[model samples]
Target: MATAVLVLATVTTGLMAGLYLAFSVAVMPALARVDDTTFVRVMQRINDAIQNPLFGLVFVGALIAGGAAVWWHLDRGDVRWWVLAGAAGYAVTVVSTVAANIPLNNRLDRAGPVDRLADARAVRRDFERPWVRWHTLRTLVCVLAFGCLCVALSVA
Candidate 1:
């Protein structure tokens, strides 16, 4: 059971890290080349689409499984610290997302349609930089968590 939990946590965190990494490397850069209106509209659509069940399951599941992995390994002297580190790393990922990304997303959402905006560039300007920065931080944290979990699995 503990192994299963660790695997789930590791895989989910890895997947999320990959998602964010892709955005930082590819998506955002690609979006950067587009006009402000296109960028704003595309990003808004992406934010809306990303809130669905599959993404939610992975996002929330990583935290739950990571926590469980930490708890389950607490008494297992060899792997406990690694698992705990994994949990801590994932917690940072969650905190950065909630503290920084979500608010930016919400603000972008509330900005309404890009086509209707008086200044679509202003909307994009407000959302892009901070969102990318927070996302990069989350990606790094999540990758670290995934690595810790992988080490725990090997040591366990």
Candidate 2:
């Protein structure tokens, strides 16, 4: 049961890591090449689109499963420590997302459509760089969590 939960945690974390990796490596960079209007418009659309239930499930599930795995493995010394580490890493990812990225996303979303904005460049300036930095942090921590969970699985 513990192993199954740990596997679930690892898979969800890996999925999230892949998402962040995709944005970091491909999506953001591609957006960077476009004009401010296009960038902001596409990003706003994406932000709105990503609020769906499926993404929320994996995002929150990763944390919940990681915590459950830790509880389940508490009696197993090696597995407990690894699950703790993984859970801690994922916790940071979640915190950072809420603390840093979501606010920026919210601000951008509130800025209304790019076409209606007077200065799309200003909006993009406020959002893009900081959002990317936070997202990069999320990507790293999530990947670390996934790796730690994978190690826990092997040791178990």
Candidate 3:
């Protein structure tokens, strides 16, 4: 069960990190180039697709599994801060995605073209940069967390 947790957490960490790199870091600049209608459509697609409730379930599962693994290892005196780091990483991810992006998405959904596209771009610039920053922190935390897992594995 604990091992399962670790694997799931790793999966969660990897998935979010990949998304951060692909969308916020890579695709967003190009996405900014589209005309208003297409831009809104694409952004809307992204907003709709990104944060499914089921996706949250997957993330929660990963945390639970990984934490359980850490707990199991720590019970035997092979302990570390990585578990906490993983939790914190995911927490940052969830909070930032929910707080910043979701509202922007809602705004875009309700807004019209031209003006809305410009507004979306502004919001994207302000919010996306910070999102990337938090994502970097998340990746770091995941690295630390996985390192702790490796340490646990080694001691066994």
Best by lDDT: 2
TM-score of each: 0.96, 0.98, 0.66
lDDT of 2 by residue, 70-155 (tens): 99999998888989999899999999999999999999999997879999999999999999999989999888888998899999
Instruction: List clash counts for every candidate, in order.
Output: 0, 0, 2
Q: Compared with the true structure, what per-residue lDDT tens digits does model 3 show for residues 1-156?
A: 656566666666666566565665567778667754566677767766866887777666656666666565555543435555555556665666567656666766666553545565564555455645655665555555555555544554
- Which model is ahead, 1 or 2, in terms of TM-score? 2
User: lDDT score, residue 36, model 1?
Assistant: 93
Best by TM-score: 2
Q: Which stretches of candidate 2 lie over 4 Å from their true place?
A: none
Per-candidate Cα lDDT values, in order, are 0.91, 0.93, 0.60
Q: Tell me how candidate 1 scores on lDDT.
A: 0.91
Error of 3 at 6 (Å): 1.3
RMSD of each: 0.9, 0.7, 3.8
**Cα deviation in Å at residue 45, candidate 2?**
0.6
| Candidate 1 error regions (>4 Å) | none
Question: lDDT score of model 3?
Answer: 0.60
Q: lDDT rank, highest first?
A: 2, 1, 3
- Give the clash count for model 1: 0
Instruction: Please give the distance, in angstroms, between residue 143's alpha carbon in candidate 2 and its true position after superposition.
Output: 0.7
